[model samples]
Target chain A: MSNLKGWKEIPIGGVIDKPATSRLYKTGEWRVSRPVIDREVCINCMQCWLYCPDMSIEGSIEGKRMKLGEFKMEYCKGCGVCAAVCPVNAIVMKPESEFIDE
Target chain B: MPVKLTVTGAHAVAQAMRQINPDVVAAYPITPQTPVVEYYATFVADGMVDTILVPVESEHSAMSAVVGAAAAGARTMTATAANGLALMIEIVYIAASYRLPIIMPLVNRALSGPLNIHCDHSDAMLARDSGWIQFFTENHQEAYDFTIIATKLAEKENVLLPAMVNLDGFITSHGVESFEMLDDEVVKEFVGTWNPKYSLLDTENPVTFGPVDLFDYYFEHHRQQEEAMNNAYEELPKVFEEFAKISGRKYDFLDLYKTDDADYIMVVMNSTASTAKYVVDELREEGKKVGLIKPQVFTPFPKKEFQKALNGRKGVVILDRAMSFGKEAPLYSLIKSALYEVPSRPKLGSYIYGLGGRNTSPKMIRQAFEDAFNDNLVADEQRYLGLRE
Candidate 1:
């Protein structure tokens, strides 16, 4: 036990070690294209959640009213499925390279 | 009270399993391994244990069920032999990678095609690189003792890795031998309840299992498995010491019989070591300097110990029941590598013996010793015993 090296102390395996892994892993970086939802037109149908592969869509409810649907960009893989399934043309897939300066 | 029972290796291991009395036993019956699951099934049916005996359809499912049940934080065990292991090999890797402490009792047998189902190490050798602790037992007594030891060792939090307790097919599995059993209550207290660190059933935590990790994280996770393996190797002696306190049988990485001052040494594992020991004893009585080294743990192989033990010997013979096919025998290759750093290392002899369950008599074993004495052995050349020209 005394001779064990620090690298040999890693408790790693296939299971997820952290909670709210979305915050721990910024999966949005994987996106070549990002989904930008136009809140003005979002009907809060939560259609994005219905079609999201990673279920990266979220909407908070307030005062008995559902809020506008927002993309959890940290986890959205930019598959554009949410844009494709939106009932209205409220969500658009934008080139990720355009936002690289920010 | 510890009662001495004359039982076959299969039954002996089952007795240990009954003591460990894991939450799940999901083995598919195969050849020499059948009797282990059979006896365990009887324990389940007679209500001696609270285990859920899952009668899985195939070896693949058997291991899959084990992995799944283990994920749910259940203490799990399974047994298999030969092709059944070959079938379950894929998930066997998954169980280890998941860091599940599943103890499997593997009956050592030849792998198929011209299919023979008797004693050999081919089956155990197949999983050599599978990142699991491996225990090679020489007889029914060892098979029994190591099963208990493997349970506690595998479940250690820092050393959470699966393990295989290997015994030769029919040779140990069917041959009756006398073994003393630790009382169930004592064994129960010794191998205390498993409190898993990662439980799929922990709904409050809600963490992913067997999740996909791309190249970015996969390599790190693999490195962690290596660390866990090292942890097992480092921490194992403590468990062995604890077992010794209750059982009074001190265990070591290698069983070095007459090795300290011998001129010639033979290295073997599992049941073959028994025959090799008999031959060593005979040669010693005849005023010859012969010794035998049987490795108890195959994985995390004791390289330093081998280097020290065989450093100044006259000649060394490594008898492997499994061949590497187009390469030197597996055990031979490992021992040869272990000797590379020692300047005073003995000249090595590689011998492949008892393939597909061929008979390895004491006379056959003596012939290998005779080759070592005459220095008729080349380090690179492979000789055979009990094989026709």
Candidate 2:
């Protein structure tokens, strides 16, 4: 947010000074429920990664096997699309306030 | 040597474009404006100009393509009329809001309901609040001259706003007239290369072009646009001064004809002013104290200049080529607002004339002046000239 300037300092077209400030805003606060992934049962189908509206899911290939990477909590609005699209039920939508990190 | 040519307003604009040799021209055709782009397209085909001519499917795409090209740091232009302008109006506002200095030669035509393809100011009037600087031209000479002038004004460093050079459809656009053409080298020197402060292609200075400006910053951006508009009003005379040096033709916010000591004056714009000038001359020979005021620049309204021109006149008649429906005509209401703070103002009368290309002869214009004079210098109500009922 420090990158943001007062209205007077902004250019004529309301151009942003920095590129892609979405990384700085933690949109997770906007969510009432959050998705928790169960890696053990996850088939690595990459369906959740493709279905996430906020593009919070990441996928990678490891030794000829596909695997899910870290979830970007800063941008995840906790939309249940990722959890609902999981064919193997490897993801669950837990209440945001009740979920505690290990 | 300066060349002379007898050509239509559309061809004159094409000749100007050829001399300017813009970076891109993206346009789709509409009636009365097709010849403008058509002529330029031939130049492009013959390798006369190094412009990228984008023949888009629709006016929306035309404007969209130009917006993209202009954001990418290219000097751009386009032409449209009537329904074509209406179709591209959504992007027209975006072009101004983005501060892209695109020059559009807008041929004025009536907005359709009965679907008439004729000359009127309705199309240009509809885009009055769209933030583009508008210059209304009287004839083919002005149509050619203002296009070059508009390019310089739009590209001013402190006043980077889009501009429209408006000429009446069919009347000026199709009518051929003889005018002196500036030397190609002189035109190139007059309108120098466009220098953009920030462009989409500026990788080292990576800045966003258009961003999602919310409630927090949207108002401020608008304030900046307003400031730029004010700057345009100030910067216009300086450009006209420079242009006059080479061209030897003087220009101002409005053209005044024998209004200095006249008692009755008619305020109008575009081709009708030429007809009214004859009426003024005939009335003057009859010893009637009548004059004429023709405004060239429509946007930035030039309130103070108009007030000064209209000062001390006994009766002033304003003619509108387009109607405003439930209220007073557009120019009439605007003139009233311009004179709002003046301590003394001339008695104001308005008439809606030339709707859907109805003929406004010298006789009808003479009657407008006569009506104003016979009304005892009191503006009773608005009237329509040449209306059957």
lDDT by residue for model 2 (B1-389), tens: 78889999999999999998999999999998999999999999999999999999999999999989988899999999999999999999999999999999999899997898899999999999999999999998999999999999999988999999999999999999998899999999999988887888888777787877765567878888898899999999999999899899989999999988898899889999999999999999999999999999999899999888887677899999988888888898999888878777889988889999999999889988997778644454888788898
* Model 1 ranges with Cα > 4 A deviation: A1-11, A27-102
Q: For residues B224-259, what per-residue lDDT tens digits would candidate 1 score against the true structure?
A: 888888888898789889999999999999999998
Interface RMSD of each: 6.1, 2.9
lDDT of each: 0.89, 0.89
- Could you give the interface RMSD of candidate 1 in angstroms? 6.1
- Among the numbered candidates, top DockQ falls to 2
What local lDDT does model 2 show for residue B382?
Answer: 84
DockQ of model 1 vs. true complex = 0.27
TM-score of chain B of each: 0.99, 0.98
